[model samples]
Target: MAFYDDGSFHQATGVSRETLDKLRAYAALLEKWQRSINLVSSATLPELWRRHFADSAQLAPLIGTETSTLRCVDLGSGAGFPGLVLAIMGIGQWTLIDSDRRKLTFLQEAARITRTSVTLLPARLEQVTGLTADIVTARACASLETLLGYATPLLEPSGKALFLKGRDAAREIDEARKTWNFEVRRIPSQTDPEASIVEIRNVSST
Candidate 1:
């Protein structure tokens, strides 16, 4: 989608007024924290609504609406792109995991300011275990192969993983298949045409 303002987000997504208010709060917080820390790419700040908010918001439609609640775990939730955005949208029960404490601190404050609830895991992917969820997500985190390794243990039996990847998505999927076997599909991204959302299910080591 083309870069636009908050009105574009509201018109496209049709999110509630409360959600929009929270998103506005999130945008302000993200911009404030970015000066002191790298919350998002500096270049994307000017178009925050289109670049970040809308990019993350697009994933909501892909998430099945059949269920009233979905337990979601976001691995390597740096500055909470899809994770924090989804939480603000009230997608479901959220667990955001990241290795950086400072980022987590920023997320904590953002959640407080937006009044969004999330379970934050301030730990590395390898350090976490016995965590399962209906939906597992990651964005700009790691290679597809490595992401599968991190997401594998957190998936519920019927869960699926939605990974946002850039132009190298196809190459990463091909490489990931060497050590893993699963049903995977590529969903074209609305924000960046060259990028894609890789959805994986029934994952297992080959």
Candidate 2:
């Protein structure tokens, strides 16, 4: 359960040696940045491989095999958990959005250190426009309703939204259904049993 090193991470995710090296550099940067920026919760730092790396990597399998051509928008990408990690894993073309200038700075450096190309947007999710994506992703970003509001406008007609939700996923889904109509598939989280990866598509207003 404790993935304290890159070996454990590769064992769990099956990343190639080259990808694993990049992740190592990425993790090193995260640790160094956390000293001043509070990139991630300090408690979870000890388990960075499993808590952030693997947690983000798990989405790759669910994304299917067309990653190279897909455009993904990540909302509120604080420390770029699912977004930067996914990009490093070669999942898709990623655009990470966040309002904090400091965090955006960190993402810029992280992307460079990991050799992962990603667009860093220094703006609120609601302020973004004129950009559409094949997929939208967020983790600990917002409630299900608000996330849908942010995702719907940017999502291509055939696109899907992948949200990592905590224990209240079912409750949030029920509440979201009050104002939105969408087909959802709930996949259990590989990292946390109490969490779930919510995949939504064919969305429309109620």
Candidate 3:
């Protein structure tokens, strides 16, 4: 589709032609609704494929398709990139958490338009109380240490935190380790090799 460019996403997410069609339909809806809400950057619309779709689709590698349905939450899911995408990727239950009511409104509308099954939490990330999920995903939200403060409390003892990060990810992980006792995995990011997906887990008091 003209809106998408990343070929790796189709492969990585195991999205067949039909699923891609659904995603395209969702993108179209998002693009239309984003006009009044600012769900995503205007500059990103042209390169939606490589920039948005693929960036979010990269999570499939860490959590494979055909796996049983599991619940996950996206903290500060500003525009519902990864959380909404993850829902379409077959997560049984998904939650999009953000403080801005307007963004969550757009996310809720996007879910309605995309028919994505997800819950919306309109509250500050730090105040929302919930169970640790199978996986917790956040993107472009905060630094590793700050993110740890927000995400760690939402993760189960064995649950993993999949955070999308850029070049400074490794250093951030190093900094976060000073207070968080968790195993970290850095996987190559499809959007930018210099970027990484930091999977954080084992968040227990040392």
Candidate 4:
């Protein structure tokens, strides 16, 4: 309810009432299920709107209205942050990849409830095969270099990546630059100004 209104979430993603309602339902479900399963950081639950939902939704702009039609993959989809957010934003296709079946179950249910089209894959990102996407995203997935290793093989040429990272972003980028040649920019995060987003494209290995 009040959550959808906070965190620059609606502003970042331009969420419609239909989608916003679904995300609201998702929040409720997350709170309910989280009591049993470790979906999100418990300490972050009190501020779930700004901490989780809004943080996830802020990446919607990177999807761009044009890219919304492209196939996308969300690796290590723990709590379906930007991945599920992207689904609500009307991405043509989305696959939530994770090693945990339980999380996949939640993702699938979230997709169904939200009426957002999504595919759930219960497997390690490195082992998933025979698929490629126009965009690959991961929030709290892994280090940038390791993330590239997991995401690059599945990305189509001209594909882009949106990763969420904290204060150590520059160090992560430096490590990523050791083996990857891509244009990476850090955008100020709407949730926390001290935080930033790592946007990577023109992916190449050094």
Clashing pairs in 4: none
* Model 3 per-residue lDDT at 130: 55
Question: TM-scores, in order shown?
Answer: 0.97, 0.97, 0.90, 0.92
- Please, what are the lDDT tens digits per residue for candidate 4 over residues 20-133? 788788888888889989999899988887877788777777777776568889889888987887787676488888898888888888877877888888888779888898
Off by over 4 Å in 1: none
User: What's the C-alpha lDDT at position 173 in model 1?
Assistant: 94
Worst 10 residues of 4 by lDDT: 1-10
Runs in model 2 with CA error above 4 Å? none
**Rank list by TM-score:** 2, 1, 4, 3
lDDT of each: 0.90, 0.92, 0.79, 0.82
Using lDDT as the measure, the top candidate is: 2
Model 3, residue 91: C-alpha shift (Å): 2.8
User: Global CA lDDT of candidate 2, please?
Assistant: 0.92
Lowest summed lDDT across 10 adjacent residues in model 2 is found at 1-10
